[model samples]
Target: MRPRFVLPAAFSVAAILLLVSCNRGDLPGKKQLESEQVQASPVAPVVSSKVVEELPEAAVSPLTVEQRLEDFDYMWKIIEENYPFLEVNKRLYGEDWLANKEEYRNKVAAVKTDDEFFRRMRFVLSGLNNGHTNFLSKEEYPWFLESYIRAGLGSEPWVNVFQQSNVLVRYNQKPLTEQQQSPKESNNNVNSGETGSKTGMTSGNVKKVIIEPDQIAYLGTRSFAGNLMEMDSSEIRDFLIEVKDYKTLILDIRGNGGGNSSYWRNNMVPLLINKPITYNTYSLYRGGDYSEAFMQARRLSEGLLPIANIKDEQMPNIPPEATTMFRNYNKNVDIVTPYQSVGFKGEIYLLVDSSVYSSAEGFAAFAKGTGFAMVVGGKTGGDGLGTDPLVAALPNSGYVFRFSLQMGLNSDGSCNEEVKTVPDVEVDPDTSKPLLDQPAIKKVLELAASQ
Candidate 1:
């Protein structure tokens, strides 16, 4: 399925002005008031004047109630037509979807400001209880950093922790440890300079690779985003080659919000297995009026033969050959064969948490099902059942929204979205201490040693 492309918002001038003013020790009372309002109100407060000045002139125009209503209607229609898990959502919400739509539409009509309208629409989308289906308004995009700072959950602490440990770290497309460590200190490792095979390979989503004191190779991958699998594959391949002799490998995907499933199937899985494997038993989508055509087009676009391209005329009196092809096409089993001389022979351990979602959750499910790796840590964020999402933009607000177009079944042919992939050794993080100091790592190490 084609992943939805979310349009990036232009940089907000209002946000920049707010930051500058704050740096200059201005708007102390206003900042406090904004925080209080954010905490008290159901919706986040509107962007302050300081932020408004920084925003582009085009975004300053006030949205009319009619415009907001139109946007709401557009979003609602898209979800109503494209959203695949209506039965699942009905089971979840226990209300008629149409009734819920009417109720939200009435609420949308009453919204006055742009922020209020966005919030109401967001609330309506949240009713589906699907994280894959949601909205992020333009106003919320720029103020994300400010909100994080006010909430006291900035990245400073995490950076400090990694720096203090003197371990190589990469996050947010930057080399954190490389910047902190001296040239002399950095020269001691294989990753310090441009080495053959690892040369020109950007870290991308591979956050950190550190060989622990116990000789267990730990790799923290934050996301499977973009073409990171291809970008970071060489680095991981070379790292695995270098650490091939290590007894254990720890693939930490604690906070990995997944991107592409092909990452695991094509890049990672080949390096871990020596034989052919079937990761998904069967993949099917909800049939609709245009479902056959859609599937045919999708297959053709993906460079696959549209063997199940059943015509409207062929529906009632389908040919025997086409019927067989349709059955085969519907049961789309994902199979992969290992790369020669690239498979890892040592034991593999996967670290996960509730933040492990989307393709990450799929990875965990596959690993557990195939016995490819032993998962350790908390249950996954549970995004495996929802298929690829369809992106739609609001006509007036231009706010982007995504909803799943299909429901995926687990490897075992289960449609249980509520049942998250549990770890083999469930070790929760230590809330009192930093993640680096968590006992979970110790438990993983112990488990590895025992194995």
Candidate 2:
């Protein structure tokens, strides 16, 4: 649920053209800059050059205690001003944000090294209990590549290979003659030629269309991050078109950590339902003077940007009074119309697991709430709380951190934060085996065949 006003480059160009052509009579006056309150620098007493040389190099390092304090203060101010879930977090976690800040500031003052500073910052962020929030230091950037790879595959290298090979063998019930990788398994491998790879192995794979004995079509992906529309236009479209003749469809997203929601909205949902639907009932933003200014800038740049293109009658008309407050600054209700070209109209089964998070959780929620699919597998990782997180950099250490400035609500008007989406048919995976070997998928196959 990224801001609609944050348009693509081409869209921004179009908006600029529109802005230039329109009258600027309604634009707000330029804000006056407040007078700066400058703090006086401590004066250095005259000292001998020889005394300075005698001091240890470690004592004169750039990342001094004072510098770390300054960094922490900067971070604290930003979160205090912008974090959207302050009240919701208090209700959910009993968090006293101001108290936590005071406690953490004391800890920051005690930090003796750069590593300690980073660790303490991470500890403070972890207290939020929001998976979307994280701090990544400059030194940790290189670690991201390795960590990402490990996250996709299991941390244990041998276990990942064994699990993938075992799942394939078990599902097909036949030893491969060539021991070659299937497109789905190949897609997961870092060495594979694909440009971008998404998803961890939490979800089962539906790489190649496997038509079971009773005309059940199985389609699996590890993630929902890439250009699914292009994938659909090419191989997926061909597969779905072929599968339209099948009796039932099983869409697997077992290990998927969510990506962009548009992949499902624009490419998948249209193929499933014949009519328009409302998925997201409402959304809330952390509004303040800053947010108001931000929204005004966006509105000026991109006038009345539509979140989704639904029929006129289907749109949720948000009242002007609702938009007046800080929390409701950019709040919106989303209405999605199905893609008109999709023709599949059969029983749909969705496979989910703890790895399914963020936008993927939204999919599971929508499907379950709308009775669109019979959800199977373990409860999905409930991470649909905050929309897109806003990123900021630490002034001193150059470390980057992200925090969500908006909280989304379910169709029932409940906050999505920390609310796990349970499956209709629960199937726990065997710890010793791959998720694909779990009875959940087997049950889906059985149910699909019956349908």
Candidate 3:
């Protein structure tokens, strides 16, 4: 059965009105407050009589700090000039944050070795308090991550959560590339070994337990990190071909935070089909016509599809077949059907958690709402809205700040900017074990067996 969607006039109008309210804000009042501030400050009166001359622009470069005081001063200036979240920095650092920076710089200067400098930098970066932001200099990071930081997080690696510390926790089907590390022992602990060819082989590196019975296949992809498509396409192809026999499939994207969705269509989905199927799409309107008459007319003229305009990219221009596809103005789309759906005729389940964010959570929300799959897990991390973020590096300091410009909506045109997607079947991690476990695998087995 195809999924159903209906956009009501009242809801659309309300959303538009909300958008209008958000855009037109306290700017006029803020300007008035600024004028009052100028009147109150004694410097404001002196500025009128004094002729201020513009100084020549200074040449900018990375700081060379011989002393800890200089280093701390440099770091504070950089953060104050460029930290991504200004409000957050203010709240955390408070009134005399500069004094703290100077104090830290003094501490750094006291350090006797290069190791101490790195340790100090780590501590300084930690003060930012964002998971996405960190201070791993090019010397410390792998080539891929180094390249990514040079380009920024907008193009970071994707990873699926698999085995953590030698216990199986969940199932992931997304293909991954095994990174090769030098024998000196890499700092990051990623698996680089072969396991048995057993279909339900549990990972010795994982911390949690994930089990798959006979009916369904469970591949715990810890993340969509690195170049899965380019780096390890052959390994993924072989794995998918081997597991193509299963009817019921559970794509454990609970840990997938999304890299490039194109990899799924290319290396993975092609192996599962002998015939083609149409995935629905949605036409998102950024402006105009939230009225019932307009909505009805548009709906009647152009039937609703499952496409989502979360990303700002070109989608397929034509209806996609197995091999060739078209681009849409909408950046991302939820799958109602795979392009080729000849094989694998059974239920699909999506396992999610608070860690499931951005494009990953977007897909889960779509699948759950449209019945594409039975979503099982905890709330997603992101507010499900697409972020159109632009990163800017501070001129004097090499720090970068990213700000979101665009927001996206769900099928009903509801703004998911602040609210995350809640799972249909919420599964909490079992607290009994030192490591948490996902129950979706057990549930999928039971459902498949019953069927």
In candidate 2, stretches whose alpha carbon ends up further than 4 angstroms from where it belongs are 1-61, 87-97, 137-206, 209-214, 227-233, 289-326, 329-333, 340-342, 429-437, 449-451
lDDT of 2 by residue, 1-451 (tens): 1011110111121111100000011111112101122111111122111100111222223477887888888777777776766665666678767677778888888877666666677677766656566664322332222222322321233122222432222122222233354323533453233322232122122375665744777777655553233343344545677777666778777766665555565546565565554444444554533333333433422233233322232334332222332234222334444454446766888888877777677778767876778888888765453334444556666556656655555555555554567888888733246534668767876776565
Off by over 4 Å in 1: 1-56, 59-67, 86-99, 139-215, 288-297, 300-329, 385-387, 430-437
Off by over 4 Å in 3: 1-214, 269-342, 383-389, 403-405, 430-438
Give the Å error, residue 409, model 3: 1.9
| Model 1: how far residue 38 lies from native, Å | 7.2
Q: Quick one: best lDDT, which candidate?
A: 1
Model 3, 331-350: lDDT tens digits are 23432224333344556666
The C-alpha lDDT values of all candidates are 0.51, 0.50, 0.38
Query: Which residue pairs in candidate 1 collide?
Result: 13-54, 13-55, 14-51, 14-52, 14-54, 14-55, 15-51
Judged by lDDT against the true structure, how good is candidate 3?
0.38
**Candidate 1, lDDT over the whole model:** 0.51
lDDT of 1 by residue, 351-428 (tens): 887767766777787777777788888887664533344444565555555565454545544542445688888988
